[model samples]
Target: MLIGEVARHSGVSARMLRHYDALGLVRPTGRTVGGYREYSAEDVRRVFHVESLRSLGLSLKQIGRALQDPGFTPSALVSDLIRWTEDRLERERELLERLRAIDASAPTGWRDVLRIVELMQGLDSASAARRQQAVLARSEGVPAPADVLAGAVLAESDPHVAGALRWALARSDGDGMATLAAGARSEDADIRRRAVLAIAEMPETPGAAAMLADALRDADTRVRGHAALALGRRGVTAAVPVLVGMVVEGSNDVEAAEVLGTLARDHGCADRVVSALVAELDAPTADSATRICLTQALFELSVATAREVLRRLASDDDRAVALVASAFVGELDGRSAGDRGARVRSASGRRKPRR
Candidate 1:
């Protein structure tokens, strides 16, 4: 067969076939009468073989070694190829993500695109300060896209930077909410923790309650605790059990207690909150510290609802518990009925500022 015939059949261009011949990768077995590069059957087969290897991301040098070196390790060669392909794929994916972020931002001109590119580089920078500045820097109408902010927020380890990113994400037209919701469901506990924390601050967010409700069931205590606190603030009853659990576990139990007290303000929710607290207190599993925390938490509830529970806790076995519970009872005893109601109302209504 002639080189033209082989090129036509093998789909390798003639120029490439000549280049392959020059590299000694595939040499024709004979010459035609016209002196055109001639290819015998074996040579044509070698050409196909080289092209096949090329399809697996092999360089010409690697393909030549694969075909010619008797000692070359095929498995090692394929492993390297796999690694290279994977690396290329990762780079391409990152590029695609940046492109998507830019497209999502809907930039109006080159300046917007450039600003976004600068922000993206800063977000991915090694310096936490640079990352912080990236999130805090004004875009002058070219807002950093929400997905970009969301990704930065999830990966951010610095507390101040993460707070800045969360604030930026919240203010970014709410597009980042979906990214945050997905992060809440991530298998990575750290990510879920950060996600729920960010979502917790978004009570004004439309679907944040549903995400928080799901997070209440997370295996990580921090994740679920954050979700419960966020949900409780929204007045969602679904957070009651988790909030009660937070109180029992002593995980931010004070904040948890305040939220519970907030929920307990509703007459219907009041009994349920008081009952869950009572159950934990009565359980032998609760240690002195757990009982004490539970007592403090219960104190957040209205005196009308938890007064009886308080009276029972006053004479409890633990001296600390008795002291704390006795102190709570004494304080209520000194209040007029209206003053007692006002006291509970005061505790539940005050909220620490969310980032």
Candidate 2:
């Protein structure tokens, strides 16, 4: 059989046939005397296998690997594929049900009408397997179920649909923490940020701490901040040095300060971390926000070291610094005026005499 005949018999396009040939998935059995390719009956069978694997949502690479294996069994692969398809379908069904509920409550509009029509069109145009395959393909390379779920959330207008997808994705652990961590190195900042956050929420597993530590240095401020927060939440004190570095760099300093405060409060490094954060507060180049965050963090630490830092900042000439210092002193003293003398002195230092 020629390529044309194979296309005609198999109901697959010539372009796809060429694709399979390129992938070595369905190679020609021989060549004619004139150098044209010829497919044997067995070659057609191989094409069918390729098509079947593709229909079951296997990528060309995955199919190639399975086909090359001596123990490969299409029936077993198909069964597993069926289970995955069924699970995806159930998720979509749950999402649709939630959307239906929301639709009933909301006022009907052109947008709502269009959404219903689109859903109907999707149902009319393809079988459930095809739909699931399309969805899975679109979400290829997503590390965890949560990352895919986050994408689904972004796709839907209804919160319920988004929420349902999130629930489904979260419940399914499709990939390991290592895969999710690798996604953190993706060139796409958004993907990297989401991947880091997903791993942060994952159950503590081997190498999870190391992955979090690596994510703490991510170029994206949000990714780094979330990594720090995750470490603090898990009471992983090893992240303190990295969090302190972020504080010094002024990247998401507020979040870094909060995480440091949490570390100080729950972990044993309260005194040392608080002292470092206070030193940062006193730096001449430190921003007003950094100083404010440091002040708040000191309050959270609530130790003698923190109190001393607050006292020094109270007399700093920067008005913003003085204000935060006054607030901290007031919070601790039960009255606002205990720091009043220092505040007056600082204000006088900044005062200009009338001409």
Candidate 1, superposed: residue stretches over 4 Å from native: 337-355
- Tens digit per residue, CA lDDT, model 2, 21-68: 887888898988988768999999998988887887988887998989
TM-score per candidate, chains pooled: 0.90, 0.48
lDDT per residue (tens digit) for residues 139-228 in model 1: 758887989988887888899999998888878854688889888888999999998888776547788777878888889999988888
> Listing every candidate in turn, what is its Cα RMSD in Å to the true structure after a full C-alpha superposition?
7.2, 16.6
Candidate 1 clashing pairs, residues 3+ apart or interchain: none
Give the range of the ten consecutive residues with the poorest summed lDDT in model 1: 200-209
> Given candidate 1, what's the lDDT at residue 216?
81
